[model samples]
Target: MLTIKGKLGIEDFYRIIFKEEAILINKDVLTTVENSFNFLSQFSQNKIIYGVNTGFGPMAQYKINDSDRIQLQYNLIRSHASGTGNLIPEQYVKAAMLARLNTLSLGHSGVHISVIELMTSLINKNITPVIFEHGGVGASGDLVQLAHIALVLIGEGEVFYKGERRPTEEVFKLENLKPITITLREGLALINGTSVMTGIGLINTINTRKLLDWMICCSSAINEIVQAYDDHLSLELNQSKKHKGQQQIAKSMRHHLKDSTLTRKREHHLYNGNNEVTIFEEKVQEYYSLRCVPQILGPVLDTLNNVEKILIEEVNSANDNPIVDVEKEHVYHGGNFHGDYVSLEMDKLKLIVTKMSMLAERQLNYLLNPNLNNILPPFVNLGTLGLNFGMQGVQFTATSTTAENQMLSNPMYVHSIPNNNDNQDIVSMGTNAANITKKVIENTFEVLAIETITIVQAIEYLKVQDKISSKTKKMYDDIRNLVPPISDKDVPMYPYVNKVKNFILNFEEEIYACKELN
Candidate 1:
């Protein structure tokens, strides 16, 4: 079980979302929440505060009586529950809920303690709101997406309960749960934040970190199969550049290639003969794809590091507008809910991931083409030459997928369109950026899968499996365990590709079980 006390970290959020851990609110946070509620109750009913006694957005000037405030909150939730895309994955919904709950726990949203308890109970009971994927401009706090969640709190929307989709009221009755009434600014507080975008970004950051490690492992295997020179990965040479990511990658490459007979030093094949007149024959160096692994992937590592920090701070921040200060007795209205920070970071992340996919595709090309592969059979076809196309179609799929990733890599931060009656004249498409980034990550995984299977096939064709490094040997064996190597007979590639992708997804566990293999 995890305890949310208004100060949740990224890792804790990960566990709560992915591991389905039950949550408990800190008693101190509950006291602070009650204090804010009491402070708000002291205000006269005619006070014209945004989303409390007055209307929202451009209609903020319209005042409401005490009798209609409750109805106004309900109407705000129902009217804004207009999300239209496919249902968001349950994990993301759960993450959004946790983020929203964490922000409210800060005790500045002027919400009653029962509101927080109800949200926490939804998480503990595995009752996830069916949030949609569209309708968020990422400004004014993911309004549409979050309103879908807010609707469920009042038993007005659908929810997923025990793996079945049902009305929130039916689920509440089945689980002995009761919906709470929204009071004062509670409805606005629930939807007015960056939780949707922040939750998606946070989850992707964690997964991308694992994917980076796996990409390095794949690059190491490709280097050994292509007989890359190890001088470029020398610690001394990398230290001259003075980049932490480059130096770290160089070190990791050395460790990955340690005890491998296939990786050659530059001098081993430098000269054709000892005679002074002899020509310097033999391919002295590898292609940039294999030689510049650290240089190309180094910046991606740094970007991931930077993005993770921003997401951590965003998740832990009080991103709601009109923050209530109990100690100062003030209601300060501000734009803390803008998602530009996450939008820009996610856009950068997608571009970096697209470059990684491009690199993987180049390596895959090198492994399949006969001329580039240096004596490897065309398409690494082990079967009858003309009859079997061997990884030919597979490479094409990878190429096309990488192209799609490139198309999706355009920065979303710069493409904001005005909406919401121009009240939100400038918007942050943070959620759109994050959603497409998830697709890019998935596509990159498929590209890496193609590369992994192709590398294993090359090692098998060369009959040099025994010469691979111990780390590559483990990884190669793991791949083979999932799907057999390409043989003389041609077969459908989708099933095999999917199996390898799943293997890549679960590769982290294999590395954990064997510390030296990653």
Candidate 2:
């Protein structure tokens, strides 16, 4: 079980949502939450508290009567539950809920302890609220999307229970769960935060790191298959530049390529005769895809590291507006709800991932073309060259996918538009950026899948299976276990490609378990 004590780390977030760990609020944190609520109760009925006594947004000037205050909070949730487009995945909804619960547990949101318990109960019971992909300007804290989730808490919206969608009220009654009563500032506290964006960003960062590792591993395998020189990844060259990512990538490549008979020094490939010197060698160096793997992918690793740090801080932050301070007995209104930090980091991640895709595509091109490939058959066709169109069409698919990723890489942070009746003018499009980054990740995975398949095929054609590194050999055999090696006949490659893509998606955990890779 995972305990939420007003703070959540990125790795713990993944384990809670993906690993299905139960959650509990710390006792001390629960005390803080009750104290804040008690303090807020001391405020006068006529006090003009934002989202409590007064209306929200542009309507903040209008005050509600004491009898209608609770009703006002209920109406706010129902009205703001206006999310559109496709529903967010259950994993993301659970993550967002956990994030919101952690923020509210800080005792700054003025939410009742029951609200926190109910949210934890929903997660522990695997009940996920239906949140939409669209609807959120990323300002005023993912209002519509989170409001849809808030509606489920009050037994008024939809939820996915036991892998089936059901009405929230029906599930609550069946599960013996009671609907939460909205108190002063409870509804606002639920919706006024950056949980949605931060949740998506956190998961995306984790997946991106996995993809980077696979890319480096595949690049090393391709380097051996192409018989590229290993000097480019030498530690001396990398240490001279003094970039941490560059040095780390070079070290990882060397480790992956360790004890390989296929990799050769430049001198080993050169011929030195007793007579007049007549040099005989393949190219002096390799193309940028093989030669500059560390240089191109190093910066991407750096960018992802920086993005993960920012997201961790965002997840643990008190981003709610009108922060309740029980210690000072004051309510502070601030703009911590804005998602600019997450938006900008996601934009940067998108751009770097596109670059990674480009590098993968270039390596695929090198393996497909007969002239570029080290005397390999055209399109890696092992059978009759003209009849078998081995990987020709698949290479085209990779190119198109990489092109799509390039277009999606355009920065989304620069394209903010004024919204919310001009009252929320200059909105942050953080959610939009995060959603597109996910698409980019999906596309890049397919691209890497194509490269993985092609690299294995190239190795088969060269008959260098025994000469490759042990790590590369293990990776090759693992892939061939799932996807049979291409024989002397043509076969549809989509199934094989998809199998490899799924394999890559889960490969990170496998690596973590392997003592050799560690």
CA error at residue 396 for candidate 2, angstroms: 2.0
Model 2 agreement with the true structure over 370-476: per-residue lDDT tens digits: 78866688888777877778788899899999999999999878788887777788767888888889889989999999988888888888899999988888888
Backbone steric clashes in candidate 1, count:
0
> What Cα-based lDDT does every candidate model obtain?
0.85, 0.85
What is the TM-score of each predicted model, taking all chains together?
0.95, 0.96
TM-score (C-alpha) between model 2 and the true structure: 0.96
lDDT of 1 by residue, 441-500 (tens): 989989988988888888889887899899888888888997787778788999989998
Residue 75 of model 2: what lDDT? Answer: 89
User: Runs in model 1 with CA error above 4 Å?
Assistant: 43-46, 271-281, 508-518
RMSD of each candidate relative to the true structure: 2.3, 2.1
Q: Residue 332 lDDT in model 1?
A: 84
